[model samples]
Target: MSQVSLVAARIAALQQAGSALALLQATQELASCADASAAPVLVEVLGFNNPGAAVAAVKGLISLGPAAVEALLQLDPVNYGARAWAVRALAGIGDVRGLELLLDALGSDVAASVRRAAAKGLGQLQLDELPPDQKQDVQGQCLGALLAATSDGEWVVRYAVAVGLELLAAGLPAGSPERQQAQQGLLTLQEAADGTPPVVQRRAKLALSRLELQ
Candidate 1:
């Protein structure tokens, strides 16, 4: 069979999956196929209650890269599950097209894991292809979001904030204000003792050290 036919067959299997295990298997196969045409089906699987299937779908969407961004953006806003999974896929893809969604998720998503992924995604965005002014503006936005997210109640999210700060700073000039602000944010996280988790503090300290070395 042709590759297109194989992908279609996988999509059909995913659509017709009658059991949890079957859905998982079909989603896995489709995701592994990494066909751009499978992006919609993979995204649809994110709305399902099955986590295993959703994980596979996220992988598939990430594999599709920027081609999957529009479909992910169009996911039903009411379906928080799908949105959360979409955030993860966008984070993994690190496409600049996902910038707004990642910022919103980091600042307001109720799910800590989603916020964590968004924080990381904001830092990892591919900005090299953009014009210098646009790149700086986007980096500034990401920096502000990561700084705000440092105070997040979840330790995991805070840890991700540290990560985001480091990544964003790394792309800026050594003495640039944005880079300095990012370093300051990391320092604040590192010194936070007011209920901050030790792990988060350690991660922040490590991020600060790495930034200094750069």
Candidate 2:
């Protein structure tokens, strides 16, 4: 078989294996792929018709760590869900450079789910246990991204953004600038509560509680 055909066969077998665990392992092997020719095929596995396969593939790609970031991001925009998963997986690896890709994803993605995943990943990355100097700028940028998404035309996007902010704000000090900014953002959200959907209102309220309790 030609190298391309061989790689495709492996990917097909991995999909046929069907378990999340098996697919996860296949993703790992795919990530180790040395042939640039196989890269796109690896990404396609991430979009298996099966959600389990897709999730496993994403987990595997992420396990590749920083090395996989650029390739994952370069996938077609039609595959935004896969790309969003890649952003989360990158964050899981504790790499902040992925933050830029996350921000860009939020800004340009029309899909609420993808944007939300990026937002959530950004928040988790904030609590990465990095040193203050390293975490500060990214945290600020995360807050900004969440804020921008809060006003997104879609309720799902707004709710996701609020949830991201709340997760990132957890346990911040009463007098901290972060807490203050969160409170301000909540106030802005509250002012628009009448128009906000039930889900988003719930998220906004949760964020408010976290900030005020601080």
Candidate 3:
């Protein structure tokens, strides 16, 4: 079958899946195909109450690459609730428009998940994709926002910040102040053994160990 027809069939199947788990599974299948045609349906899926299904849709959009980003940009979330989910999907699929949304979301009093996703996106950005003149400034802002968020009220947000800081530190010059600070911050998270979940603490420790060797 043609790729277009296959995506259509997949979208139809996802729409027909009444069960949340079934929808989630179908969504992931569409995502694995990485077809741009699936982006619109996935965007609509963000409104679903099922977190797992919404996550699968977000992953689908991310897999769609630039096509998903463009489609997401055109969607105006008149409903405030949908806006956070849109920002999250944007966070996973970085484009200038998506980056703009993430930067704003990072500083806003939005959902912890939104803020966490923004932090991760900022760290994963390809600096070279940005204009040369804006690259340094944006990088600094990404790291600054991430470092300041190390003590976020939510452990998950703090864990995401730790991951961002670790990734940022990995690419920095030897003995750079930012690298030192990022490493210190990750260590702090790791040392907060009791306060943090084992999973988050383990992530922090892993990041710190890698950064320590860099």
TM-score of each: 0.97, 0.68, 0.76
Please, what are the lDDT tens digits per residue for candidate 1 over residues 82-111? Answer: 999999999989999899899999999999
- Residue 88, candidate 2: Cα error in Å is 4.5
Q: Which candidate is the best by TM-score?
A: 1
TM-score quality measure for candidate 2: 0.68
Cα displacement (Å) at residue 4, model 3: 1.7
Judged by lDDT, which candidate is best?
Answer: 1
Native-to-model Cα distance after best TM-score fit, residue 194 in candidate 2, in Å: 4.8
Q: For residues 112-206, what per-residue lDDT tens digits would candidate 2 score against the true structure?
A: 77776777776666345777766776678888887777777777767767777776777355677986786677666666555687767767877
Error of 3 at 132 (Å): 3.7
Model 3: runs farther than 4 Å from truth? Answer: 12-29, 78-81, 94-97, 187-206
Q: After superposition, how far is residue 87 of candidate 2 from its true place, in Å?
A: 3.2
Where does the lowest 10-residue lDDT sum fall in candidate 2? 31-40
lDDT values of the candidates? Answer: 0.91, 0.67, 0.77
Task: Tell me which of candidates 1 and 3 scores higher on TM-score.
Answer: 1
**TM-score of decoy 3:** 0.76
The segments of candidate 1 whose C-alpha lies over 4 angstroms from its true place after superposition are none
Query: What lDDT would candidate 2 get against the real structure?
Result: 0.67
